[model samples]
Target: MTNHTVRPRSAGALAAVLAATALVTLGAAAPASASGPACPTDTIIDGSRLASISPECSFAGDQVNVGGVVMSIPNPGASVRASSAVAAGYQDVPDVVVYRAGNGGVAAVAGDQEFGSEGTLAALRSENSAVAASARPSAVSTLDSAPVVPGCDDRTAYKLSGEKWAGAYEWSYNNTGSPVTSGVARIQDALDTVTGGVTRCGSDVDLTATHRYLGTSTNSVDVTKAGGCSEGDDRSTIGWGELSSKYLATTCSWSQDGIIVSSDIKFNNRAPWWDNTGRACQGKTYDLQGTATHEAGHVFGLDHVAPATHQVMKPASDPCEYSQEKLGAGDAEGLKRLYG
Candidate 1:
């Protein structure tokens, strides 16, 4: 995948829109409750050390926990309205309290920090519900067509000796914060979709096993708090090959690629994201499989197409749309030309 910049709507603006929409549909939204077994203290992001016999060592202690992790206050304060809780500590008096699930683990809440345990729990549930409602398919609108760019074949498309290599390539996922469990499967599916669908290329490209590799390289997809509407993006780069006898060098691996997906965005496969008027599109989230499929196209050498074309290579897509999970005619044509 080549690096192409396509900025989506700002995070702050998107949040506001979602918040307003959520308010209107709150009556119909599912009830949120804080009901689950006590989370492990080891997963909490608290600063205090608990003694072995300390009664305060539990999740119900001073530390706030969510999804089996202790939530930390955001540093430098958050500007987004949704982050009011985490931004409370910024001022002399903590007005709003916000907590994060360590290393952007997709859990965050904001409310009055001084509230009692019951109040805090209620606030957490409300915040989670509002956030969920805001991310619905109806909350997002498609953008205009993406600007055209040079296709993969135009430049170097990660090939060697004028031939796209055919073999199993090893890949690893960054499991530092939110462990890469199901995400790995999503990525694999995307890779297979492109390789198998593009039969015209013969057996020029095939991605094999994805295992746990402790070693670091440019080629990997890691999750972190990337502040933007875009779900994920990747960059494909080239490296120098072996030294030539005639004192010349050739391009080598098209393997130095980096992919990063936003931890802020919730990804799922549930459908019917939007209401009939397309106004109450809550509950539905972005499909990780579909988005990964598109990103994998870039890994296998594909570029962004105009949204009007409805190609998987289109620059942008809404949360509930999964049509891109499979290759479109335009997408297949492009792959055939390059791989064939």
Candidate 2:
């Protein structure tokens, strides 16, 4: 199906206002737990490695068992549409983290790092709850508007605080256990819509960025079945897998120094995926294109606003709402700020 939306204009003004708001809010927010038994000072001193370690490792011995990628998670919110717990809301886990362990030591869990996790993630959330609450919306982008759109104020959006595609990310597809009825074309179209050169509402929006599909991949996505990040083949992959009930699909991205290095998109095998955009929205079944479009936004560095805000970037999905296949005015505007 074709994508369409209201034409987008510059949201630089709104972005600036929201950014300034964040600066002030963070400055005033209380500090999260820094040192304690859960995270002793001897281990990177801040417990950044808590989420990826196993029970036996004692937060130091196991070390996520990945290739030197030490992860630290701290978000007191169940969020980004994918927020909450690894059990109830795996989306709360941060999709990207600072990749500077060698020189920077266990990267001091950035107060601004929106996504975070550590195994069960319960401790991480409580540890940072006050700080996270304090940093809530000091201001948001409401300058751009198209009330006809789902999120009436397309400006109600946010992007990953750090790391975006420094170049066009050539990704691969994996369909080993997909539940998509429409087959590969439908999924491919979704990927293309997100990468760049999409038209909305007969209006061409500047949604171009570096998200490309390099054909099918033999590897599975690095996202865990529980909806947390995992160390996989290191290939940027988009494919099918088991995800928690809360997510239509889960995305995990890896970055190095403010540049997106790789990412994985996993469509839930449990979801009854309907790919025919021409058809009406169905019960329980979600639009593959629409939902995947949102997951792709996360891959390309978009963050979730609130669901009530009503943009594609909202953290929750409404079954059968195919309009999400196209970037809303706010979605486009956010991309413009990052990629343009």
Candidate 3:
């Protein structure tokens, strides 16, 4: 058996704003208290080749290996044909699995193998055949299509009122224009400029929202780590001060009578590695305000900023100087696509 890597372009992949390592764990749309839904196992396809596979740390802290290998079964959405094309009615079946590319590899075993309908077998194979095993596999299901991303669908807009922004943070965040408090205001101001001072999307569309908050002193679960922002070498040479472990990233969705939007998260502290002049670790510090502005875009469902720069949504920050705090033309276009 041979392992083939699959790499299909996600509708949301282009809009993903966080680093490749960052996992934007928004508050589930079901409710803040809602328990995570079990990974569905309905569309298990048997007799497929191991096309692509990735490892993901589940919410339960268990490591789940998801694969995008080939399947003998037809893709759920498309007309059965030799040519690969996603079907008309088929939304991708989330959490599907392909087997390891080796002898004695099992066929369609439950839990071990999850399934996604990649239009056609050939298309799925073509898109993913070269995916590397080392890359962290993202969720196969429509996690990207979730109604609640940071910048999608005017989700973050509703949270931008002076009151809403002020309320989400601690008392210390109230200073007039101090670097920290002022950073918070600048982020809000940028959002206000982009959204035209509107807090809600009047029509049915992708919504976005963003806000700032103080972080915990320390926690095993931190956004900076989960989003893989602090661990990479890019941050070290970029001259960010330090990475704070307490920073949090969360997205929440709400839908009862057809209301949907989500918020983004950003941190405002330094990483311990920032002080180490010897370049001990691959770390970076950032302008809390600027990073927040970018992460906010993501929570609202925006991807990374194209033509990357010091702009809010760019994956890596430039050296110590935080210049591009304002949203750029690309940022505005993304916001409009999601909302306006």
Candidate 4:
């Protein structure tokens, strides 16, 4: 499988706040126990030895099975979030894709990865025999819409399918070698804040974390540490999340499969703008919970709101500001529209 890497937008003021560092590449393959059933030979990529094994197999090198389909990545050690949507009978034919974005908030490539050979209409009919014959045409024509936060520029949104997650989603932190002291707790709190805010929309969709450990690798959200002080200097953005791209048409919701937060930036829970006189006008630490909350919003469906402070989805976060930790009116409205 061929891999493509796109650079995210530049980090502006964040550069002044934290020192820069080289990007850490993550490419370890998932163990053999993680492999699923073997797939047909035709489904494998050309010129790759992966055709001999199960589609779920993660090769010794940079190749790994994402949602039962093999994918190649630039950095084998980078965390991956893989998801798939398959029709019946063609259990071997998986409509899946893997996506990755730099630290900057730029969007992920939509049509970059290839799935498989384009089969004839008769082949589709035969493959989906279990599906209602009458519904076959619609199924064939239906294309999953790209999973993207609604308000950001089209360029920065991750090109994934809008696959809504069911029930309360779980999240865990991989803080090994992380610089932040309370990284796990702080990020969990931020996720909770965002989930609670969206719940106010009266939607059934929610997020919860019962454990901090990385358990069975399925659809759970994994919050990992990134090596960057500013958004684009060290990495591409302050943080970015990956979602499944094959299930977009079923629902307009995209399951936030993974997130990476930069450790180079300074963050604190203290309120912003407090003076030396103990008055509220002179503090400078960015709110960690607030930043997490913003990133969580992206995991959901909200995008960056312009003018900086109109809502939690603002494109750029101001240092020492906590207004985004809570959902704004616009944020609530977006959730209601998507989930309600």
Candidate 5:
């Protein structure tokens, strides 16, 4: 199995990183269960000395399965959003294998983790197939109450893939431990900017669906800053952390019966960001507020449309671009279908 786990950092730094997310993850380094992996002891016979056994085993270490399974992110986009439907059978759910990350993030697996025997690797492949959605504010010091990203600027045509928040859900922010270019305030403003009307793209329209900001929290995030999602926490958190070199940001979501219940957002700590406020990107930096605005659209259940369509939910944001800070008519219309 490929060890894609993020390398560990200093104890203090790792704690700070772990404190920022709450997307259904297990505490690191939990002691092994007395009987071992939660499989039925009688499965094929405990007489084989494999100890206890059961379906859906929750390993003490690394909550994500570390078998040879490698899930790849889609192309042309830096971030990936992993989602699954809750079901009785694990096979019924699709688990997104997290790519390996770097230091200052979660533990990255580097080799095969032996549990019982190599023969059992296939069975363990399905274990820990979940993502964390936890969070807390880290280094963002200011909260820009004013709208940072403008709305109604895009003129591109787009269509909706159709998923959304039911009624009104709430979300929180977690900082990067060390302040990034943007502060918590500006991030909030960017998020709020997504819900209203799109007023300038030749087709002015109103999107009435709404969500409340719950302020900042220390909840561990679903996707660690190191580039993977912890499974099963039901909170929607936003925070900063190290991601794979390819990603600028990532979001993890889970739902049941076709309704979204949990979602978390993690901005890549390694990426250059502009708050669209005091600090600006050097040669080419991502507009923090704009990226945030787009991620919020995903938290609200918007799927990515191609960038050519010009919707805020497109997979990629332009470098130093601010257009994504607001919703396009297509973006709003999609939300309208979900919550309207």
Candidate 6:
């Protein structure tokens, strides 16, 4: 069996202001586990092993399996939200991809990943199976925070694929590292604790990444300056916040299956997971698991946490304001509404 895992990164240059070291709240504690391609051991990738596993997500790692079993983020305009359930688009969840090392071995066979309503998703699966033999992995980034690709098409809804690249996409950490494993429930609890569960989805608006390379690229950012200071006048374009000149921007891309998506994870310099505030952002070096989970919500089509108080998706104004260690009630509702 092949073993694969997700990647990791250090902290970011500027501080977004949410306060919570390990932003996990559900699931049990266990080492990161693989749910795809059959893994007997953990897969490792260095500068040299990327060529062996030929790892691929539904569409450029945009689509991933939940708990290594269920597939998610399978369509465009499907309403991916950030950390808050009160927010309208928070319903969409990004898919999780699994990877493992491949050293001149044939790629392992994979089972069909189904989504949508039972019947709808089933038919789509059958259609995809007919063509699964020829599918290949797209040039999509597998990092937690990827770049945003404009004018990209969602996964085709029914298509099977393959790839020549070989390697596993490792999970930086598992739910055990998180405060909440059941992301949906954790989010709901947050809402009740704060707003008494009265808030509802606000808008069905469309959010586009002004920058490109949603998950893989290091360049393409709209905010921050070249000096990497959070306290410059120009750094206030987005707001009056510190900026980091060396942070790498993420790319956002679409999946061919028309479901999964990708984007970059942004972190504040003051946060615990982020140790540096004035250095460059390298997709290869930084590995903040919690921060990545927060960004994953956005990449899947969710927006920032709502109520600005509860929910992991909310934007932080200060290092202390960021407090979404888990998904709140609002987060769960948003997802069910989007997919269910």
lDDT by candidate, in order shown: 0.31, 0.51, 0.27, 0.32, 0.47, 0.26
Give the alpha carbon lDDT tens digit for every residue of 1-340 in model 3.
1232222122232233222314322211111112221221212222332222111101111111223322222112111000010111222222122222222122232223433323333333432332222122222121124224333222222111000121122211222212232444554544444344122122222233333444322222111222221111111011112222333222111111111222223242333212213333233443443444444454343443322222344444433323334454344444444343
Model 6: per-residue Cα lDDT over 262-289, one tens digit each? 2222233322332233353343332233
Residue 260 Cα positional deviation in candidate 5, in Å, after optimal superposition? 1.4
lDDT by residue for model 5 (1-340), tens: 1233432223432443344334212323212233332222111111122222332232222333324222222111111235321111112122242221111111112222333333233222222221111111121111112223243333223332223455666777787453464567666776667666432344334455576778879877767433445553678877877765556667676544234566787777776667756654656676777777776776665555654565666666667666776666556655554444
lDDT of 4 by residue, 82-199 (tens): 2221111212122222322222111112223432222221222232232222121211111112213332212222221222223444443433333445555565665566665432
Model 4, 55: alpha-carbon shift in Å?
14
For model 6, how big is the CA root-mean-square deviation? 21.6
Candidate 2 local distance difference test against the native = 0.51
RMSD of 1: 22.5
**TM agreement with the true structure for every prediction:** 0.32, 0.62, 0.33, 0.37, 0.55, 0.25
Which ranges of candidate 1 are over 4 A from the true structure? 1-168, 179-181, 198-284
| Comparing 5 and 6 on TM-score, the stronger one | 5
Q: Against the hidden true structure, what lDDT does model 5 obtain? A: 0.47
Point out where model 4 deviates above 4 Å.
1-161, 198-284
Cα deviation in Å at residue 77, candidate 6? 13
Predictions ranked by TM-score, top down? 2, 5, 4, 3, 1, 6
lDDT of 5 at 24: 16
Q: Candidate 5 — worst ten consecutive residues by lDDT sum?
A: 132-141
Candidate 2 clashes: the total is 21
Clashes of 3: 57
Say which prediction, candidate 3 or candidate 6, comes out ahead on TM-score. 3
Off by over 4 Å in 2: 1-100, 107-146, 197-202, 277-280
Leading candidate by lDDT:
2
Using lDDT as the yardstick, the better of models 2 and 5 is: 2
Candidate 5 off by > 4 Å? 1-162, 202-204, 225-227
lDDT of 2 by residue, 4-79 (tens): 2211112332243334444322112111222211222122222334332222212222122122223322122211
Better of 1 and 6 by TM-score: 1
